[model samples]
Target: MTTKKETRTFNIENLNTRDGGEGESVIGGYAAVFNSPTEIGGGCFTEEIAPGAFSRAIAENSDIRALFNHDWNNVLGRTKSGTLQLSEDERGLKFEVTLPNTSLGRDLKESMQRGDINECSFGFIPTEEHWDYNVEPAKRMILEVDLFEISVVSIPAYEDTEASVIRSKEVNEQVEKRMNLIKKINTTLEAI
Candidate 1:
């Protein structure tokens, strides 16, 4: 069965350790690691890099406000590192995809395919600034990422929710017909 969208949460304890005390609370604030997002590269763009100009891409995330940057898709020449990201190296061709509908997905696809998308404002938080406590930047580890794709159409609670219900029904019918044909062939073989 296909699983629908669900909200998941994880909690970590003992982040604050008071230098010499039993339970450190002086550090203050909670630090969290998260999965980064990446999108497929369709074309070119102008992004200032350490060396020179570079391309950019974006992907959709479960969190509506959350957005992915091309850095997540870093692979062969894609980034300074020699490691491949979504290419054919890490594991398989694992890449983020936008649903058929939704404004962001629609808009993002247009940019990749046509290079005419709007300026997607995305930035990396210093980590500590977002929290109440002071924590060093670039020292956080990624824990987990919650991935999600948005569809323009809403899923039905029951009955028929899929927009391509007809397609599914047709395929099922085709399978049943193929089974009957196989049964007939087996019967003919037995009689012969």
Candidate 2:
């Protein structure tokens, strides 16, 4: 199953670079919120990154890499080169990354300065989620999800709720079709 990805514009104000001398720098911002509804794909959905969302993963010391444009090979701030930190707050999840003085790191910092990169996207496999059809167009509540890589992107690919809700509806439809086919086969056998 394809996991859902979330993207949000990072607050410029929250972005700060601490020069570690000789070119080392750090950049970060709030990557997600708990109760705010963001328009994704063309629909509206609100996601909550629960309090302990990252607890298990953190305990395992998973290698949560940081990339640019979701390019897996283009790993930026990592444990070896620098560091990537994720923390919880009253609003949502916050991420800070220390960048090495490498060419890639300089390029990223320049891009951010030039306003070429201002958004962050994260990938997660949902452990539990619910769609409240009681609300118009339905509102999805992602109670739990396994955190994955967080990337800096030029344009967010997850603007609408289609990726989450529409995909879910499609899955349900397929299941229903299978059930109907099984029922028809059983009916024919009974008649025989």
Candidate 3:
């Protein structure tokens, strides 16, 4: 199947670590939301990014990478190797990345510490979408997507989006895990 690449920006809701001294940092927030239409390319599109969107992809391949500014040339961390963790919550996909003690990862940690980087951009390929013309301008809703990479960026295009990192444990992690399981069960049952 053909996959269309897309990126969504979120304000840094939480940045778990700084100085790269701890070796791990958790980045959490909504990567995308349902019924929210934002201007994309030359038209307006509402991305669903439903709960089940990343289920199939994450199951089949968990080796997703974490890059700097979405640069393929720079490899900061990954998921399958246990360097990065990913999940889908009620708001959107959340991440817990184990930042390497390397120079690159350290730099990333510093930038986040200084608030120089407050937005995160995730790259994904759309798996399912629909067009709605009932509104003034034609719009599209991306029902599902396959995540590729998550990056730390400078500017974000969306509003009310957050991507900050914090030092304490977030209560939402457990909540997301439970929600994911529930969604998976519901999806499987729907198929039956």
Candidate 4:
């Protein structure tokens, strides 16, 4: 089975760019916040990342990249090269990307400093998740993930019509299936 990769973007208030000695620029921020609920698929469901979700992936030393707008061609940093550093702290997955001395990097740094870009995103494949169908719109707790990349983005693209519709359908199906199983269990108990 092919694993579907998902991307989540957050409006990070603390995302900042600073000089990294020798006039080099660095951008840093929390890519994913722990226990923060975010509405997904046009409010069809809510999703949140659980603490330690990236622990295993980080411990395994996954070669993740830091990109601009999730565009591979606009690569900024890589974990393997020491340009991208990732850590899971109490708040969430924090990252620091040493901006390259290139046109793309320089432009990104200027944009971030000007507050034109203050959002961060991460791409990952969910390894473990818990869904709560009892909730009104349903909730998904991402317990673990195989992280691939983090990006400093100007806009969030998760709400594109076609993608949202497809995800909403998948979430609704899961909720319905679980609800049926729950009803069957309750009925069996009442008959006992």
Question: Could you tell me the TM-score of candidate 4?
Answer: 0.87
lDDT of 3 by residue, 1-192 (tens): 324365777665645553234545544444444444565433322334455677776777778887777777777678878877777666566676767667877787778777787777788777876654444344456667778888777666422233221101131343345456667887899999
In terms of lDDT, the best-performing candidate is: 4
TM-scores for every predicted model: 0.24, 0.71, 0.68, 0.87
lDDT of each: 0.25, 0.65, 0.62, 0.86
What's the candidate order when arranged by decreasing lDDT?
4, 2, 3, 1
Highest TM-score against the true fold, candidate: 4
Across residues 65-174, which tens digit of lDDT does each residue of candidate 2 receive? 77777778777766334488877777666778887678888989888877777878776677677655444444566676677777777675643456546764664554
Off by over 4 Å in 3: 18-30, 33-35, 157-192
Model 2 misplaced regions, further than 4 Å: 1-13, 44-52, 79-82, 158-192
lDDT for 168 in candidate 3 is 10
Candidate 1 TM-score versus the reference? 0.24
Model 4 lDDT tens row, 20-46:
999889989899999999988667678
Q: Candidate 3, after superposition: displacement of residue 178 in Å?
A: 40
- Cα deviation in Å at residue 159, candidate 2? 11
- State the local distance difference test value for candidate 3: 0.62
